[model samples]
Target: MANIIITGTSRGIGFELVKLFAKEGHQVLALSRNVQPVQRLDLSNVHCFSFDLGNPNDFKKVEAFLEQWNVVDVLINNAGSLLNKPFAETTIEEFERVYKVNVFGVAEMIRTVRHKMGKEGHVVTVSSMGGVQGSMKFPGLSAYSSSKGAVITLTELLAEEYKETGPSFNVLALGAVQTEMLEEAFPGYQALVTALEMATYIKDFALTGHKLYNGKLLQVSNSTP
Candidate 1:
């Protein structure tokens, strides 16, 4: 079984992924600001830790926590932030805040875990298609989208960085998935893919050894299978 690390696991897609991985018999290290109690869960492979991705300093703590452990087989950079404000009304602080969690936080985790990732390991970053081709009518997504773009770029850079390491690295550029984050931003936006499905795809993708997914955008839409 693989040892996996997933961020933003208190709720939404992150939580779904944590459960899914555990169900698949993988050891999961879930990190988020709030961790849900799992007394009802019979799974013995799950471990939760509270972490604020916005704090860049937390990377060291994360590394220290796993320093005594074996290699991590997968790292999912799933935590993200969104601020719904028009460009003219958005501030640098707001933008920076989003970037801190979305971009820098992801990079820090990869950096911290790079050495511990075993051969044929995986790194999946959940990016949005809005960030892939840029958004036109989707206003108020400047900060969020730009941050995703940065993740895509980093995914590409890391793909090359780890090319000779023999790991399956990729970035999943997802379409709208039904989650609390969407409701928080766009009260009633419909989604094409569910969080559970997204998590399943990621888990299976990692096992495929399809390195083309690395450094490329895989948009999840209604037509995606």
Candidate 2:
């Protein structure tokens, strides 16, 4: 079993990922703003840490916990923020909030745990199809989509920086999935995929797919544009 760290584990896709990884007997460190839900899961293989990804100061707690671990096999940056509003009405604060959680937070987490990663370590950050140019662009998602685009760029840069170091970096530009975030962003609309299904694919990818590609941005979807 490998040691894995997942962010935003309290609910949605992150919550499902915790269940799948714990069921597989991997040592999972789950981080979220409120970890009570994960604690209630009652999985011995999973440990919950309460921290807000939008706040960089809170990352110290994650760093402290990872300091005790000798090796971390995978780091899944799943925590994110979404702001669905017309560009005309979007405020600077909203844009910063989205970037703080989706971009800066992910970068800080990787920097904190990178030293704990072993030779085969993998870092997988969740992106979105909305971030892909010429894919499917949606209005009222400029801030959120832009933040995800930054994540994909950052992943590529890290992969190149660490090419000789052994750890692999990749991003998954996911399509619409049935999660609370999706419902909030696009109310009354049903998605083609479920959180559990997405989590399963992500778990498999982190464990096995990393070996196949590095510095790659994968588009996970069932339909074509």
Candidate 3:
């Protein structure tokens, strides 16, 4: 089984992924700002790590933790941030906040674990359908969407960097999923897919020996199942 590191595991998709991975007997390191709530899980294979992903300095803490464990076989960049304000209305601070967590945060996590993940591993970044075509009009998504775009781009560059190696990097551009992020951003709007179902699909997809997905985007919609 793979040793996996998942960011933003306190709740939502990250939390669900931790459950699924641990259930499959894989060693899971769940990272979040506060992993206390998730620590109650009875899964022996799952370990909770608390830290702020948005801070680059916080990665040193993660690095120290890695010294105690084996090389991680997979790294899931599942944590994200959103600021629901129109481009004109969005403040620089808001934009920076979103990018800190959604873009640079993922980058730092990958940077910290890249050496540990050598050849036989995979890196999956949770992007969004908003990043796919940019034609769709979603008010206040400019900051968040652009950050996801950055993630997609990072995936392509990293995949090429590791081309000779067996490790793969891909982005799962999910459509709307019912998660706390959705509810907090779009209060009354219903999601097209449930987070639990989304997690299940991700787990199954990751397990599949599909090398074609490297440096590519996989859209998750009603037809995904």
Q: Quick one: best lDDT, which candidate?
A: 2
Among residues 3 or more apart in sequence or in different chains, the pairs in candidate 2 whose N, CA or C atoms overlap within 3 Å are none
Worst 10 residues of 2 by lDDT: 216-225
Winner on TM-score between 2 and 3 is: 2
For model 1, how does the per-residue alpha-carbon lDDT over 115-211 read when each residue is reduced to its tens digit?
8876677888888876776443367888998888889888888788777774556888777788888777677777777888877887777656354
The worst-scoring run of ten residues by lDDT in candidate 3 lies at 216-225
Quote the lDDT for 158 in model 2.
94
TM-score for each candidate, following the candidate numbering: 0.91, 0.97, 0.93
Model 2: per-residue Cα lDDT over 25-123, one tens digit each: 999999999989999999998988789988878888887887768899999999989899999999998889899999999999999889888669999
Ranking by lDDT: 2, 3, 1
Clashes of each: 0, 0, 0
Worst 10 residues of 1 by lDDT: 216-225
Full-model lDDT for every candidate: 0.79, 0.91, 0.83
Off by over 4 Å in 1: 37-42, 134-137, 209-212, 223-225
Q: How does model 2 score by TM-score?
A: 0.97
Error of 2 at 56 (Å): 1.6
Compared with the true structure, what per-residue lDDT tens digits does model 3 show for residues 1-225? 888888888888888898888888999888899887679896788877678878888899889989977677888889888788879988889999999999889988888898887667889889987877743647778899889888999998988888787578988988778888988767877887788899998877676533556787787765211
- Pairs that collide in candidate 1 are none
Q: What's the lDDT for candidate 1?
A: 0.79
Better of 1 and 3 by lDDT: 3
